[model samples]
Target: MACISSDSSDLYDVLAGRPRLTGLALAPSDDRLIASVQVINGEGNAFVPGLWEVDPAGEWEARRVTRSLQGEYAPAFAPDGRLMFLSSRENTDPFTRTSSDSTGPGLWSLPEYGEAERIVHHPSGISAFTVAHGAGTVAYTASVLPGAADTAAHAEFREKRESAKITAVLYDSGPTRFGGADLGPAEPHTFVLRPDGTQADVGGQGVVGGGDLALSPDGTLVAYTRAVAGSDPDVNANVVVVADAATGEVRRIFSRPGHHYHRLVFTADGRSLVSQRQRELTYDTPWRVTLVAFDPASGAETDLLPDFDNWPWPGSPVVSPVPGDATVWFTGDERGHCPVFRRGPDGTVTRLTSSGAYSSLCVALDGTTLFALRSTIDSPPDVVRLDAAAPDQQPVTLWAPADPGPLPGTLTEVHTTADDGFPLRAWPVLPRDASAERPAPLVVLPHGGPQMSWSGWTFGFGPWPFAARGYAVLLPDPALSTGYGQRMQERGLGQYGGRPYRDIMMLADATQTRDDIDATRTGLAGHSYGGYIANRAATLTDRFKAIVTYGGQWNLESFQAETDLHAHARRIFGDPLTQRQRYETDSPHLDVRKAMTPMLVVHGGKDYRVPVGQALGLFNDLQRHEVPVKFLYFPDESHSVGAPNHVRILYETVLNFLDHHVLGQEWHRPQLL
Candidate 1:
C-alpha cells in the first residue's frame, strides 16, 4: 500500500468501501450471535448491510444470513429460536401483495429450521422492533395514515393518493419536519404480535413508535415513549407508556412538563422500567440526559446514575437478563472515549471498560455473558464477547472483518485549559515520521452537535485520510460537547460563538505546540455545529490559513426559521423576532467582514437540518467581501452525505482546497469535481 496522498482514488476507496459491523443480537441459548455487516455487495458499487450469524464460542465463523439488494438491519432473536429483522426487500407475502412502488421495510423472520419469510408487513415500513426473552411475542413500530383502520386501509390510502396524482399533505399539529424526514400524514404506531398469531395495535392516536420500544420477558407488557402534544403547535413532551401486549390497552405511567423520557427497557422480572430522561432545551439552559429507573407499580422514579455527571450515549440500557437482577449496563462519553458503565442494584455506577465505544449491548439469556460491537477512534467496529459477571476483564474478540490494513499515521492526544479553567482534550492524527524537522500541517477539526462529542469511531468527517495526506487533524471537544459533565456542556449553551469557539482555539493552540505539528500552517474544518464553529473562527481570528465548513450555519436568525427542527433550533438559539440582539451578536454572517482566511463552503441541497440557504448565504458573503472562496454543492445529498461517490467528491474538493490554501500549492481542481 502507498501513502493515501500518492493517489486520491486510493484514499477514497479505503474510506468509502470499508466494511462496518453494526446492530448486534445474541441468541437465547448457546453461542449464536447476529450482527448487521455492511460491505460492498457483489456488484462492488454500493455498500449493503446484511445479517450475519456468528459462532463466537466455537471456531468464530460468520455465516451470511440475508442477502437482500436493499439490505437488512435491526436483528433480534424471537423466543422460539427464530431470527428476525427489518428489511425493505421485495415482500413475498402471498396474503397481502405489496405493490411494486411500496418499498417500505417489513418485519421478517427466519426460523432455525425454516426459511426466511415476511411476518409483519406495513404500508409505510417497520422502523424498529423488540422480541420477548422467554415468550413468543414481537413488537414493532410503523407509520399509519390518520383515519386508516389497518395496514390494508393505509395501503389503499397511499394508492388512492398516487392514482389521483395528489402529492399535497396537510399537518394540523406537531413538527412538519425532523432532520431529513418530513412530518407525516401518517403518525407512528406500535403493534404487538401475540404468540397465537393475532396482532394488536398498542399505540393509539399518538406518535408512540417515534422512538424506541421494549418488550418484557413474559411477553405480556410493552414499554415505550409516547409524544404528548403541548399547548403550542409543534411542541410536544414525550412520556413513558406501558401497554398490554395482548389486549392493546395503553397506560400512561409517566409524564413531566419540561422533561422527556425514551429508550424504554424492562427488567428481567418486569418489576422496573428504565429510560433515558432528557430535559427539554431552553434559551438559557442546555438539554441534559440521565438514566432513570421507574417503578411501574408504585409510580416511583429513581435516578440510576445520580452522582454520575457524564451523559450516557444514545442506546437502550441493557438490563440484567436473570430474573430479579436489577443491574443495568450502558456506555457514556467522557474525555474523548465512550466506555461501558455499569449501575448496580444499589445505585452505584462503575466504569466497566476503559476504552472503545460500545453499542448494541446485549446480555445473554442465561445471564452469564455479554456481547457488543466495540470500536475506537482509529479502528472500525468488531464484535466482542465479555463475561457479564466480570465485565472489567478484557473482551474476547469474536468476529472482526478483515483488517482495512494499517493507517499511514497514528492517533495521539493533546490537552489544554479553557479560559474558564475547564480542562480541554483533543485527539490528533499525526502522519508517520512527523517530527520537528518534518512537521505536518495542522487542521483543527471539531465535532458537530454543539451537544455531541467525538468519543469513538466515526465514518463521517474522518481524520485518518487527512493524516495520510500529511496533515495532523486535531479533533477537539470543546464546551457544549457531550460525554463531559453537565457543567462542561452547559458552559456554552445559547452561545455558539462564545466559549465553544474559544475552547477550540485553545485546543488548537495546544496541538500546534507539539513537535510533530506545524504551527504556522494551520487550517480549520467542521460540519454542522462544527461548521458553525469554523465560520465563527474565521470571523473571530485570522490564525488559520484556510477554513472549510460543511452544512454550516452562517446566520442564526435565518437558520432558526429554515431548519427542519424549527422548534429545536429556536429553543437553543432563541426566537429571532424577539431575541434580535442574540442573533445579531452570534451569527457569523453579521461579521463576515472580519474573515481573512480563504474558505471552502460545502452544503447539500436536500439538507433540511441546516438547509442549503446557509451555504448560499456564506458563499454570497465571502464573494461580497472579495475573500478567496469556493463552493461545493451536492443537490442530491442530505445533512450527512452518505453516498460513496458524493463522499469522494467532498473529500477530494476539500483536500484540493486545503492543498492550495494551507500548503501554498497551485489551485488545481479535482478530477472528479
Candidate 2:
C-alpha cells in the first residue's frame, strides 16, 4: 500500500520492469503462499517463471524458491506440504525426457523445506496438473499422437518421426493454433502420477484432453474439461469428464447442448463438482459465463446465481477450502468496480471486496482466511488478505515485491448516461500535472473481450507509459463488456462494433466536459476486439485525431472462415455466407475509403486469434489511401505482444505515435525497430 520515489527509474521503467504474478497457490497445512513470478529473461525473448513464497500473516519476507530459466507455472502444494509445480527446466531424467536440456514442462517438486526434484517427466510434457487435496496423487494432461496408447507410444512415434526426418501434421478439423501458440501433430490426453513417482494413463485409451483440470478431495477421481468434437470438425463443445484414478474409468459426466463446462472442481462430498459455464459457442459471448454444479453420477444439475452473468474470470472458480461448506468465491466487474463475491450454502451471493479488482484467489484450508493478488487502476498487483466471513471489509495488503515510489499520476472513475438510456462508465487516468492550462491529450481505449471490462487498471495494459508522459487514458466498458451483469452483455450480442462504439463516443463526449482534458486532440486506441472498434473509428468517424489498432480484425468474412475464433465470428457476425450484406457493411476493410484519420496498426504475426492478416489489410488500405500510418509488428508475439524488450518498444512507439499524430510532436523511431 506504500509507493516509493521514482528517483532512479521513471514510471514506465517501473511499469515495464515489474515481474508478472502469473498464479498463486497456498500450502494446505500453513499460510504459505507460493506465487509464480514470470519475467522476461535478458534476451527479452523467453519468460522465466519461478516460484516465490510469501507469508500472508507477514511472518517472513517474500523469498524465491525455484529459479527455472525456462519458466515454472501453476504452483500447488502436495498434501504432504511440499511445493509441486510444472516446469520446463533442464530435465535430468534422461529416460523420460529425451531432450538433452530445457525441454517442455514436466512435473517437479520441492520438499517442505528441501531442494527441487523431478517427480514426473514425460516426453510430450504436461500442460496442466492437479494434486489431490487429501492425497499425494497427481493428475495431469499430456499430448499424444492420434492413435498412440500412451506417452510411451507417443514418445516412440516422436522418435521414429525424428529419425525418419519427417515433420508434418495432418489435422482433420478444430483449431490447430491458439492466441500465439501452436496445437500440433499430437493431441492432449490425461495421466495420473502417484506419490511414488509412477505414472499411468487416465480413462484408459480413449480420453482426449482439453484445458483446465481439477482433482477430487480423496484423490480417487480426476475431473477435466475436454473438447468433444462434433459432426463438424470446427464445432466443438467443452464436456467435463470425471474419471476414476485407480481403474482409469471415465464418464462424460457434465455437459449441456448450448453450454461449455470447464475448470471442474469436486465438492467436499465428492459426488458433485463446481465449474464455470459458457452460454453459447461464440467468441466472448461465452465469457458471460456462469457457475454450474452437477452430480456426476446421478445427472442432477444446479446453476449457481442463474441470474448473475458476467464471467469475471477467464477460468476457474475458487470454492471454499472447508470440508463441508458449500461456498464459492468469484469476482465480478460491476460498473467501475471489480469485487469478489461469495456464494453461501443457500446460494445467496454477497459482495466481499468493497472495491479494487481481485484475481489469483487462494483460500486457506480452514476457509477463514483468503488471499489474492489485488489491484486498482493505478497500482500494480499486490498480495492482499481478505476475510471469508466478512462480505464488506476492505482488502488489506499483505505483500508487494515491486513496491517502489509514488505513482507519477492518479486514476479515477466517472459515469454518464448513454444514448441507450443506461449508465456508461469509464476510468480516466490523468497525470499529476493535468490542468486546464496544460490539458492532457485524451486517449479513448476500449477494452477487449468485447465481454471484458476495465474494472481495474494494471500497468500491463499499456496505460502507465502514456499516463507518465502526461496523456489521460480513458478506458470505457460498453454494454457488451462482462462484469456489467448478464443483461448488459446480452444486449451486445449481435452488435460488435455498433453499440460499443456509440458507448465509447458518448463517453468521449463526457470527457470533453473536463477542463483538464484536451478533447480536440483526442486519440482512439484498442487491442483485440477493441482493435476492431479502432479500425471502425478510422472508417466511421473522424472524431479521433488518430487511431491505433492492435491485432484488430478487418475482414469479418475471412475472419469468420480463417480464424480460430470461428465460433465467435459465427455468433457475433452470424453465418458470413448467408449474411453477406451484414458482413459487407461491418467489415471495415471494405470501407477503408471513408477513413481520414492517421492511424497506427500494431500486430503480432503469430497471433492466431486475430491474425496479422487483419492488421495487414487495414495497413494496406490506409497506405493506398495516402493516410498517415505506421505499423509495429512482432512475429514472435501472439494476440498480446509479450516479452520485455517488445513491451518497452511498444510503449515507446505508441507514445511517439500519439506525439506525432495527435500532439503535433516530431516522431522518433524506437531503437529496437
Candidate 3:
C-alpha cells in the first residue's frame, strides 16, 4: 500500500472542509434525486447547506437547488411532483408574525416549474413531516405551549412569556432535559395540513414526543405512536394507533405489556402498517427489537422476521409507497457492519448489500430501485443506487461530494476467546510502516454503549487519528456489544464490570502478542460506558502506563439518581435501595484507593446524561490519594463536544497527555487549554 509522506499526512487536514451529503429524496418519476449537502459557502468561512439535484441513471450530473444561510432538511416529493422541505428561511408572508429572525423552521414547497414558497408556518416550528404517496396530505409535528390549542394561541402565549421574561418552567414529568436542551412546558402535537392552508390536529391528547408519525397512502388515515404509562410512575411504553385524517377518530392497532412500537409506515395498498417493536428494558432482559406488520382491516398482526437476530437501525423499515406492491426495506448492524435487507410480499427476507453502513433509505414507488447513503471505515457518506429487483447487482455511486483522500493507516480486525471460552473481537488501525523491527505503541479504546458495537465509520474518538500519529489504536467490542446476537448483549446484563471488562482485557492481551505492537508502551482510553470500563481497569490493574476516562460514572447510586433517563438507569441497575449490592460490586468509586496509573479525566460541564459530578468526585478522590491526575473540563459543552474548535483542542490535549505519560515525553500543554 502506498502511504502519504510523514510531512504531508495530517488527519485534521484531510477531514477539514469536506462537504457531507446529509439527506436524499427521489423524484416521483424516479429520474432525478434531491440531496441536502452541507458545504462551506464561497467565502470558505461558514456552512451553507442546500439541496442538489442528481441524475441517477443519466450523466450523473449534480445541480445545486436552494442556497441559504439556514440549511434545508427532510426533502420529499409530493404526489403532484412538488418538492417540499423544512427550513428556517425568512417567511415572506406578511400576515404571519414569524420572520427571518425566528428560530422555528417552516414548511417550504418548490413545484416542478415554479418558485419556492412557504406553505406552512407554526409558532414553535415543525420537527418532522410525512407526505402521502397517493394523496397530497402533509402531516407534521410541532411543539406548542400546554394550554394553547391553535397556532395563534401558541404565539400569544409565547409572546406573553417572552415579554414577562419568565424563564422558569414547571414540569409535571420526571425527565426535564434531553439532548443538551431543557424539556419545556411545551409538548409535541401532530397536525395534518392541506395545500390550501387548512390544518387539523390528528395526534390526539395522548401524543408523545419523539414517536414517529406516518401518513397513509390515500390521505384518509394516519398512523402514529402514543405513550402508555406502566405500573411504576417512572416506567412508560408506547403503542401504535391509526386515526382518520379528517374525522379525528382513532383506534389502537398494536399494544403489549412490555413492548413499544415506533418507526411506523403504511403499506402501499393501505391494508397493512409496519413498525419496529421494542421490548422494554428490565434488570434481566435487554432491549430486544423486531419488526411487526399489522393488518388494520382484519386486526391481524404478524412478526415479519422472527429469525433475524440483529436490531434494525432507527432510520429503516421503509415500506414501498406505490400501489399493488408490498415490499419492505431496512438496515441492521450485523458482525461489525450495517447491511441492507429487503422483505418481499411473500414474507421472504433477503440481504442486499454486503459491506458498509447504509442510512437515509429511499425506495422508488415501483419497488424496482433503491437509493441510500453508503459509508465505510475509510470512506465518507456518498449517494449510491441499488437494483431492488436484481438484489445481487453492485451499487453504482450516484453522488459523492467529499473524499477523505488516502488514509495514512489501514484497518484490520483482531479476535480472541475469553477465559470462559466466549469469543471476543476488536478493530485495530495500524500505520503502513508498522513491522516487527519497529512496533507501534498500543492504545486500547473500549467502545461506548457497552451494548453498541464499533462498526463502519464514526467521527468521534475513532481509531484512524491515533494511527496517523504512528500509534496503533484498538477498539474492542466486549460482551455486551450488538450485531453479534441478543445473547451477547444479555451476557452482561445487570453486571457491567464483570464480563465486559474481562472481554476488553482478553482482547488487549491478544493484540499485545502481535509482533507489530509494543506491549511495554500501552495506554487505555474510553468515553461514556467505555469510560466506566477504563476507571474499572485503573483500580484492577497496573499494566497500562496511562489511562483516560470521560463522562464516566464514578458512583453508581448518584449517577442513577441524576441521569436524564432515570427509567433507563433503573432498568439496568435496579432500585438503589433494593439492589445496593450490585452498585457496590460494579462501581469504580468503591475501589478508587487501589488506583496507581497516571490518569486524564475529561468531562463536559453541561452534560446531563452522566453529569459533571462524576468527574469532580473522581478528581477530588485522586487528589486526596496523591495520584497523578489531570482534569480537562468543558463548561459550555454537553455530552458531545461538537464545536469544531473544541473538538480540535480535545484531540490535541489527549494526544499531549498520552505522549507525556505513555511515551515518557515532557508535557506540552495545549494553548487553548
The most accurate candidate by lDDT is 1
Model 2: lDDT of residue 58: 73
TM-score of every model? 0.95, 0.94, 0.94
List clash counts for every candidate, in order: 1, 8, 0
RMSD (CA, Å), each prediction: 2.2, 2.7, 2.7
Q: Candidates sorted by lDDT, descending order? A: 1, 3, 2
Ranking by TM-score: 1, 2, 3
* Candidate number with the higher lDDT (1 or 3): 1
Better of 2 and 3 by lDDT: 3
Deviation in Å, model 1, residue 74 alpha carbon: 0.8
Worst 10 residues of 2 by lDDT: 1-10
For candidate 3, the lDDT comes to 0.79
Q: lDDT tens string, model 2, 215-272? A: 7888888887776643332344556778888667875466666566667788866767
Model 1 residue 304 lDDT score:
77
Candidate 3: tens digits of C-alpha lDDT, residues 20-56: 7777898877876898887655654445668988888
Q: Which model, 1 or 3, shows the larger TM-score?
A: 1
TM-score of candidate 3 against the unseen true structure: 0.94
Worst 10 residues of 3 by lDDT: 1-10
Give the CA lDDT, 0 to 100, for residue 230 in model 2. Answer: 30
TM-score of 1: 0.95
